[model samples]
Target: MGKKRLVSLLLAAVMLLMAACSVNMGEDEPKTTTDPGTKGTETKSGAQKVVFWHAMGGATTKVVDQLVDNFNKSQDKIQVEAVYQGTYDDLLSKLKASMGTSEGPTVVQMYEIGSRFMIDSKLITPMQNFIDQDKWDVGQLEPNISGYYTFDDKLYSMPFNTSNPILYYNKDLFKEAGLDPENPPKTFEELKTAADKISKTGKAVGANFAIYGWFMEQFFANQGAEYVNNGNGRDDLATESLVNSEAGVKVMTWWKDLIDSKAANNLGRKTDDSKKAFSAGQVAMILDSTAALKGLVDGTAGKFEVGTGFLPKPADAKEGGVIVGGASLWMMNNRPDEEQKAAWEFIKFLTSPEQQAFWHINTGYFPITTKAYEQDSVKENLKKFPQFQTAIDQLHNTKLNRATQGAVMGVFPEARQIVEGAIEEVLNNKKTPKAALDDAAKEITSKIQEYNRTVK
Candidate 1:
């Protein structure tokens, strides 16, 4: 059988098994009830110490520490200790090794995709109960953010440091190329033309991207294609994937071309390396998480300048919506109920509009709440960097479609590796775009089946 036929057949078998298998997240009734304004458990006089593990570094980390201090001083009941626990993968390893050992922190920052393993392990407690008991109404929060924490119909974590990808460029390079720095590319053909012009300048080598997987997702989502099935992404609320399709293949092929022409340098298999190259002005345009802007500007400091723009689209592409990235706060199990209460306080504090405004200013992240944007302090901060609106505009332009359901497969990082390898083949001229992605789809499907086998 051909690779396509074999993969389609494999998908059929897996779909059949999926139909036969049934897994329940939890019971039907809500687990905990609430009481208004009552202090149930009191460790009077001395505040409870809640240690939180996160991946933020430098300026971002400093701001979190200040928030912790602000929260501690605001109330007499909780004291939060925030720790810079290596990277996301690093925290995953630490979290796994320390399981049931009783030596780990009370709360940890987990990337959205990695939350599932912890959720399944029963290592992290559902936080809704605590919120409910505290008489908190979650309905008041942003709906888009709720999915990030809701797993199995319950809240397992708190959304923090959330960000979506956007296009970044060096304006100086654009001017040198004789292209309007203010007139950023709005469609695919224009993007191609602008890139070619910028590359000719030799001041910087054309456009490059840090997160190819994320770039593919935004490119397709903007076209109204689904990356995965379960509700636009692995929101932990959806039940399927959408990685194999015509639109998906098209998006992959697009990136494969960039890799092929060396238009964008290899992300070098390491995000830091690509980021360094961009900051050093080795690459003219890049698509990276907006969360990196503050650092990029900080690193470039007087050497060159940076500019922001929305992702360009193909002429036929539909509106776009990207799966959110960064990390969320998962409340770990094993801590006493009182400790969980303290942790709940920390979660609420981190997400408040006042703190959100402070954080957006300090770290250059988009505000999570509508109110944050309207704040006077936020208004003043907006002048220096009007590009903050770029993220909002990007989010607003998104339209719901099958293409927007961002793909979520188990062992996502591994699946990404398979995808990266497939693109490598295209870039290296080993095969045509169609053939490369067809083989990639087959390999991806096989891995999905393998992951499914381990699940049950």
Candidate 2:
């Protein structure tokens, strides 16, 4: 069969499967309750109640709950119930299982890696549909934040919590190594020289980063290289991995050299462990997500002066950028018109300047719109925690290209694992950078082909 015909057939199959599945929140009455403060009168008023499944928990959950409460109070015609559904992976699985059913949430918060799958699932109401229907002007949003979800000149989802990678350094450690704390490294070459100096003191590891595929992906993007073919999978479906290219070689070689010199610590693949090592001052520098700034700051408060900087680039890199790492809100299509409209209204409220600023202040996530930075609450938070501004500047300085736009593949998480496995092999001296990455690329290409064949 032709590719497009195959795709259409696969979509139809997915729709049928979705219709057969349903979601149950928990054992107790479906665990899908309306707003608590509604006093059991919201349904009596014939108000549209929308369910929103999200992955945020702990302190972030508190913010989400508060926002939902506010949204409930602001309007009597609609009420939104936010459900905490474990991690992003868990949320995606549940969403898929509940697709096209009444048990399905009206809206979902999907991570960046799941964008391609969600787009092809044929289960979502494109945010563009509502935007155009309401004649909404979304020009206030940051281009880079919205760019990832925009395909074929239309937005597929609403950009919500967003962040990028950055470098976090200990100022005291830099001074102890006889390096100027104010003058941080801008390139990997400079970072190596500084790391060597810091390591000589034996007080702390020079630097550390988790063995994460996303970090490695950022390096490829910073070198102005594509991670996959077909314009980073924007122009068409990606067919193969380009991570074995010269740019990938340069990045991996530098990483291996850093480990060999004992200036870098490989904390396996756990991001939390790397963050803890840095926050405890065991490592002088670390690479982490912008969303971790609040915890890092709070953990290191009164212990040391923390410094933040952009992710280091390669010396020869000319034009490069960092891609966003966060989740976005998507509305489901298999729902009543009232439910969809209510879900869209809830999404709009969540992305408003006031709410975005509140979320940014509480979670340390970069605000999705420019107007959020102008809010009084955000301004006050920036004054107290200036490190948050570095990530914003780093994102603004990024070049807008296919590389920075990031890769969109149906099996992105698996591709990330393949790359991480390659990095581990190179670190353990099992293979050269080229050999490890070449092997990984071959495996990833196979996965891509298999996924496309199944979906198409």
Best by TM-score: 2
> Could you tell me the C-alpha RMSD of candidate 1 in Å?
9.8
> Ten consecutive residues with minimal summed lDDT in candidate 2?
23-32
Tens digits of per-residue lDDT for model 1, 412-447: 555555555666666667877677767766766666
Clashes of 2: 0
Candidate 2 C-alpha error for residue 278, in Å: 1.1
How much is the lDDT of residue 445 in candidate 2?
93
List ranges where model 2 is wrong by over 4 Å: 1-44
